[model samples]
Target: MKKIMRSLGLMLALLTLTVVVSACGSKPLSQRNVLKTDQQSKTITWGVKADTRLFGLLDTKDGQIKGFEIDLAKAITKQMLGKDAKAKFIQVTSSTRMPMLKNGNIDAIIATMTNTPERRKQVAFSNTYFYAGQSLLVKKGSSIKNVKDLNRQKGTVLGVVGSDSVENVAKVAPNAKVLQLTDYAQAMTALKSGQGQALTTDNGILYGMSVQNPDYVVTGGTFVSEPYGIAVDKAQTPFRQAVNQSLKELRANGQYQKILHKWFHNVKGFDYEEAARE
Candidate 1:
């Protein structure tokens, strides 16, 4: 009988310890000083898109993701953590970026994420770093010229899952069906495969897609404003502030303009001068 009680007590103690450890492991990242941690480690892991062109696309030749956001992240890491500090990149999709940030997998998100009221409730965002607007992409010579045309034809629109573009499309074209894909590459492929009549996303992304496929064109000028911002875990004010400050410095020192021009100067129809002014 004593041996039985001893075994029961041991089991109970082990269970209690498991619970305690699990609770600590699941603690909210907001309670920790992520900036200090990054400073100490001298590395900031950034969540970036690996599929979107001109913003963050995986280069098949070099196996490195390159584009506007990648350059900006490098500049910001240097500005915030000193030139010697390293910036690590992790591929994140619209569906995975936020969870990765909240779970402490990445230090920050420099992907083409828009700042919306709904998203603001989940994670903190830095000041507007890039301005874009929701737009549609369609194959050349297609009858669908704009959002209204989609509604008129009751056509289907492809959107990336977890992005506000899907919600925006619903608002603009109530009659049109929206098919959410995993990422931009999939959406573009679906569009090519006749799965959807139009692909809706930020114009910047659409532009990149169009550049890759001359057969597609971004039409129906922006309907919804999409101001892009860098995202960090909620309540990390010091880290957020550092990001905002770095952006300000980048703009003032002309580094921002240089980066913008480097990627966007040759993008047909994009007004690089106006973007620089912004």
Candidate 2:
């Protein structure tokens, strides 16, 4: 009897373990979610930037995130999944966004990420939401103005290692020294320390930086065009389409414009018409 009881207990334990693993690997299983938006499963995870100031940042008073990107994401979620869809924010960096999406940690990435061809290979992108151009962030009153101005004499151009902007800078300023930082924060720091003459990245990001510090300014026109898009795993075409649909709906309903004007209009040097175009 003791042997039989022990065997039964082990079988039950094995069954529990199998159930737990299956639940972890697979999304919530419900036949009803096949066609309908799972209203009961009203949870949408969005990947957003935590460090970027104007674009996305933590509001100390409310203990909530407030930014142009986050607002747009919320509007999209409400339009697609209804008001009940509780939006969950996941802090993601330049390198973490792709892996988080691929592993299903995030439903979409709305961070200030550019839709590069290389990134397209790994994920699907929506309609061009915001059009950005690569530019230089230099110290206020600095002489550096444009990529054409870059030469061996000036100084190093700081860029994050994995960012598409690094390659763009290399192509644009072959002779200029290039320093690769791990992330945008470090690159900006290097620029401040005089380790690099200027930092090259998307103008939209530089716009945020310039707003925060009058001592820093973004110089030069765009050397390369970067179109912002919402990204999802390449394999999740259905979800990708749904995201695009939400974006389209937001645009049609004027929600997109509202979100844009709320954060961006107040931002200095922002051109709305220019950003909406591809």
Candidate 3:
């Protein structure tokens, strides 16, 4: 009788363990969403930049984040989810964006992130949504016509922290000094304050800076190509593929052109049509 009771107790414990393991294994992918979103919720939380002007910026009047990247992310989210899908924006900076995505704080990141091999190790990227190039921003009448001109001892370039521009500028202008700031606003302030002779970043971003400050100009058309892509957590192949499909559909339906034109058409030096090319 004693042996039988012990056997029964052991059997009950084993069964309970199996059931608990199965429950954990069977948890739905939707429940594990980074932003705590799912089909039922019909909402996609996006990590966007509040400081970037054309890419993502907070409008002072309405207090809403608006820009080309914001519009693009919304379009993609709608296409992937449904027409009625809603986007909830969360502001993320260059340094915080990746960590936020990793921590499940945002569903997707679309704030001017460039696709690179190193980034791919941490997060999967959607197809190339936009193409830009590294360029230089300098004060008007400054002699820095191109990146080549910055390859001098007295020249210095400012870039934002967590952006590849600082390392990239070093590769192009080996002799020039490089200073990194927390964000574009700070980088620009540093430039205005004479912390750096020129600001180095994508031409599209440089153009946005120029629009705000007429005293500055974007020179050196393109030193390196920067391809932007939407990012999701690594190993999420299904979600990444869905985003890629949406991008292709957007391009085929001419929606891509409409969005691109709406933002880049007024920029002086950028060629919108060329950028639209695959």
Candidate 4:
């Protein structure tokens, strides 16, 4: 009787595991293997970067999120549902974007995430909305002029933990000493303390830091092309199409351009038309 009872317990555990895996595999979307904004019986949560300045930043005093990415997300939410789709925000960093999507913690990720083939395996991406690139941020009047000018053996670089942006730096400077910080704020601190000769990351993020300190600048040509996209779970095909279509409409009606102009165009070195193109 004891042996029989133990076997039954094992069976139950296996069943539970199967159920959990099934839940992780898919999410609610009108299209198979994509996400859609079809029905609105519930509110949708979007994952955004709370620490990155230009892309996503928290207004501590106002208790609001304000940035180019936030504005775009709000516009998408408004277009997908009625004027009142009711959207909530979840703070996500580079490391949290994928796991949160798989677990259904967020319906979509509108952070400055790049659409790469490796990431595509885990989550489906909507049409590319923003065009940013991997660039180097260095102290102004510093000797570092470009990637080719970087002395990997001599310079230390700071990056966010597990970020795709950091991966590009390795390829650009094979021998450069690299350090990973937890978030944008920590990374900036490390840079300011002279822990690293330079900080390498997305151009949009660097733009925010540049705004705060004109002494530091994003220098050199864009080394790696990074196309930003809205991320949905790989199983939510329908929802992905709907969201992409909404973005298309935004571009067709000139709303997309306005958003870019409002936040990015004002930043020096940003091209509104180029960013609008896929």
Candidate 5:
């Protein structure tokens, strides 16, 4: 009996030690240094939207995602991690981007994410790389011209889930009913089916949609300023600073302007020049 008790005590002690060691081995994501890891790996994985046109879109032909945000991420990665350092992209939606970053699936988020105070609490943001504003898109002959029109008619507005557009619409047009879809593609589809009077989102994005569907137009211009930023994990201060520095360099070297022109020069109803850094 004495020997069996001693054996049981030893097993419990070993189990406790193992548990303590396992707990110590697992460090929180906030404590990990993403910059150092990226440097060592010679790659930075970016979480980008695969649906937002003009910002990030998956080209069905080549099965590759391309757009202004993808170009910008490539430029910034090259600028920060040497020209040879590679930039990898992982498709993310508005609803998944934050959770992906928090889980360390991607190093940063360069999607068309607005830098609002609420988001700032969850992740660190780089300087405003792009400036956008909220706007409405409607069929060319539609009577809805703006937020006020929606309010007067008490119409339904289409917005993407996990985007600020619906909340903005609610604030600006309290009478308008908002239908939040899973993504821009679905919202656009709902608009075409006459489910909603207007599709609301960033003006840049609306312009992209208009380019593809000539029958639609961005109406009422932009009502709210939405400055876009690159989001990193909340603990990734060094990576965020590095991104900000790269943006500054890109602006000074004229690369930023070139990229903006590449994507927006032909986009109707959008002033690409206004987005240029002075």
Candidate 6:
């Protein structure tokens, strides 16, 4: 009787565990991937940055996130989900976006994320949407003209934690010391406080920083190529294909060019013509 009771208790425990596991199964547009579900819901959620201007930033006056990436996300959402589809934007940083994507917190990531081998292991990426390059930010009169100039014993470069820029800085300026901060804002503060001689990151991001602070300027045009792409969960084949198709359509319709001009036309030294290439 004791043996039979023990067996029954073990079976009950196993059943309870199975029930919990089934209840916590994978989320939608992921393992259970469905583009139609989003269409039916009339809404698509997108992960975007609220800090990176020209890419994505919050418009304080309107209390809405706006930028090239945001516009592109909206266009893609419309292209996939119909003209009346509503878009929900969630603020994400370089560090948080991928995890949020895996957890199904956002339907897609249009954030300025670079496609890399390591990242590819975790998520599926759409075709290259934008071409960016790593560059440096320094005080207006600072002598740091390029990546080569930062290769010195006393040279220190600041980058955000979880950003590829920190490792790239070592590759480009091997002799320079590197410090990783929490985010771009902190890295910029360190640069301004003389914590580091320069803040290194994507040229597009550096350009945004320069726009906000006239005292700083981006120097040394792109030491490394960083192509940005839209990210989707590896299982979301339908959604991924839709995003790539939308991108091709956007280029064909000249809407891509219109978006580029809307945000980057006023940015000095930005080669809008070259970026127009699909």
Score every model by TM-score. 0.90, 0.88, 0.86, 0.86, 0.90, 0.89
Q: Give residue 220's lDDT in candidate 5 (0 to 100).
A: 96
Every model's Cα RMSD, please?
3.2, 3.1, 5.4, 5.3, 3.3, 4.4
lDDT of each: 0.91, 0.80, 0.85, 0.83, 0.91, 0.86
Clashing pairs in 1: none
TM-score, predicted candidate 3 vs. hidden true structure: 0.86
Cα lDDT tens digits, model 5, 1-278, are: 99999999999999999999998766677988888988888899999999988889999999999999999999999999998999999999989999999987899999999999999989988998888899999999899998899999999999998898889889999999999999999999999999999999998889989998999999997889888999998888888999989999999998988999899989866776556532
54-112 in candidate 4: lDDT tens per residue?
77899999999888888888888777776767667899988888788777678899999
Which candidate wins on lDDT? 1
Give the 10-residue window scoring lowest on summed lDDT in candidate 6. 25-34
| Per-residue lDDT of 110 in model 2 | 91
The 10-residue segment of model 3 with minimum total lDDT is 29-38
lDDT of 3 by residue, 1-278 (tens): 99999999999999999999999865444446433344568778889999987889899999999989998888887887889988889999999999988877787899888899999888889888888889999999998898888995459889999898888888879999888899999999999999989999988888899999999999878988888889898756677777889899988998888998888788887787556655
- What would the TM-score be for candidate 1 when compared with the true structure? 0.90
Per-residue alpha-carbon lDDT of model 2 for 1-278, expressed as tens digits?
A: 99999999999999999999987668632212321443446667899987777678878899888788888888777877788776779988888888887766777889988988888888789888888899999997877878877764556899876578988988878889889988777787888888988988888888887887779988888889999998876665666677788888888888888877877776778889888774
Residue by residue across 1-278, what tens digits does model 1's lDDT show? 99999999999999999999999876678788889988999888999999999999999999999999999999999999999998899999999999999888998898889999999999999998888888999999999999999999999999998899999889889999989999898999999999999999998999999999999999989899888999998879999999999999999999998999888877888966545433
Residue pairs in steric clash, candidate 5?
none
